[model samples]
Target: MTHVPIRVGIGGWTYEPWRGSFYPPKWPIKRELEYASRHVSAIEVNGTFYSSFKPATFAAWRETTPDGFVFALKASRYCVTRKVLAEAGESIARFVGQGIVELGDKLGPLLWQFAATRRFDPDDIAAFLQLLPRTHEGIALRHAVHVRHDSFLVPEFVALCRAAGVAIVYAASADYPAIGDVSGDFAYVRLEDAREDEPAGYAPAALDRWADAARTLAAGGTPDTFPCVAPGRAPAVPRDTFVFMINGAKVRAPHAAMALIERLGAEPQR
Candidate 1:
């Protein structure tokens, strides 16, 4: 009856500082994803945001990582950075048809990020959501949206996302608004408050707290203390949870992700 799982990791694998601290001394640059995927259950890939990669590249990535590892890709800027979001169908189609299915089951959620200046226009956002294809190349796709503007805090936006089955990313950042409402069957969390001083990137107690939070999310429950746009709660049902240690104190992100993985108990990334 267990239909939920929690995945924790960092954004991307390559970092100059992690060469020694996170990776083995003088580890081969080409095998960084292979190494990173072993230590964590999931990784949020940022490279897809600016450009496109051939199917072979995605296939190679899948072969390098372990069986249970999952990679979440950021949607292309071309799809989210335009004035007319609804008109992005062509761009969205290009990105979706770009042979990403090469990753097979290793592929996870696609994060669509909007500019901070972009306010919540219910109709525009809804149109853009409709443009997102539920399935591509016979593979089911899960979508998550990240909005930096505070104007997205309105209940209307939350209700819209909920109806569309697209997750609203819980961005734990001082500059962006955090919405912990469960809009989809899955939960996406972007933690951006890592500290340089803490070796684990976060205090021990903080990691413990996040571990608990992740458990709650996987169990189809939202933390009551977290910020929410909607007044009422969604029906609690088992949900897969994804948490990535991102931005803030970027250098310490890997450590923070590893810490979370350790706390969650390494059970072969299932």
Candidate 2:
């Protein structure tokens, strides 16, 4: 089956610049999102866990942004604790439901970012997985399982996700084992900046190689993997792709995204 266009975005809003030339300016949330939307189609909300999503904020977000934009929310800490796993279905359900309601239709995916100490407990994982409702009929929902510490990305986990019909997120970080065998109509790739000295965006030479590889992967249904090498640069694999680079200095997401769009020869967004 033909896949949807790969939707690429960044991790969050705002960035700190090292140079004194461009100082950071305080802006409204909607304005920030609207500015981001000009280049990136989506963003991952890391702050969602730090604070609850008020209904009013969600309304403002929907009102200020254009249509066809997306947001990926990180699940709250309370929803994934050891206590919640012990017969706390109501709590988890309410949390997820509230997140969906607050994010509304623009919500793209729910990221399940596990703690560093949280290991792979088959029973716990299954229990947590069962608590979530399936993706809505018209909406696309992906449950991204991110294990911070050592955890097995075993075939069984991939099988469970396949059966459940949830897209698993694959983050390309240095020194991390590449998890394969994910089954879903869609997928997510996070390219975090690994090189501190390098520029805070995509590297041109690297993009040349990755773009070719991505096209090759798209031609066939074979499995492919992309790893973060630098800002805006990832080793592209075959198949549909959505890459979000999280390394930017003073709001460089748009610049990096524009670079990638030009590298891919894909239509520019703005």
Candidate 3:
């Protein structure tokens, strides 16, 4: 079996609560990414979802992180919030053109997260997927779509993602719809139910379940997971998995990520 790489991390490095706990005390704000990169193999850049960043900023981010670290950027709101998905080509282009390629190999997946109100429209989604560039400046770009609406829980939606080679984010949360379908060559998962009471954020049993699921995904088989609306066919090849501990009980997210990494036997920096 191929040893598929699995990266575990939190949404962002800069959080007030994590200052003294997750981050070293008296650590400079500017060096947060540098420190976080040493511990977690990956990080989801949530700031990009709110605003566009300059090329220099992206370059600086790339330079700060260590080698083998991955930064998954969230697509800007303008690119995904339009009433008509077909008309979002220019917006999407502008977002992608904004020095994202500067990250180079450090760049991982580009996450396109839709609002809960955004229902599933097959034609609209297909048009938007078509607009996604397969490559950015000759570098291959991976795309992941995170649909929050329950309307997206359909076989047609899964088929569209599979055909487009876009990964559908497996977001496990009680408040939001969780879809365990694997569509693309990679698996993107966001764990949103981390509890503050639990020392590791997630219960030990829950982490074990997720670890097993990650192993199965990396080994090229879809594990029988829950909260799935439509279970799609497995991919022909094994896939690398990116798992992020996000939202609920946000303060303990880093701890949760580290626990999962340890469970996978990926040594995290102390």
| TM-score list, all predictions | 0.97, 0.76, 0.95
Runs of candidate 1 with Cα error greater than 4 angstroms are 1-4, 267-270
Predicted candidate 3, C-alpha RMSD: 2.1
| lDDT per residue (tens digit) for residues 157-264 in model 3 | 988998899999998888888888888899999999999999889999999999999888888777787455565576557788999999989999999998998899
- The residue-level lDDT of candidate 2 at 179 comes to 53
Off by over 4 Å in 3: 1-4, 227-232, 268-270
What local lDDT score does residue 90 receive in model 3, on the 0 to 100 scale?
Answer: 90
Model 2 C-alpha RMSD to native: 5.9
How many clashing pairs per prediction, in order? 0, 5, 0
User: What would the TM-score be for candidate 2 when compared with the true structure?
Assistant: 0.76
- The local distance difference test score of each candidate is 0.89, 0.58, 0.88
| TM-score of candidate 1 relative to the true fold | 0.97
lDDT of 1 by residue, 144-260 (tens): 999999889899998999899999999899888888888988999999989999999899999999998898998889986578878888789988899999999988988898888
Top candidate on lDDT is 1
lDDT of 2: 0.58
lDDT of 1 at 244: 93
C-alpha RMSD by candidate, in order: 1.9, 5.9, 2.1
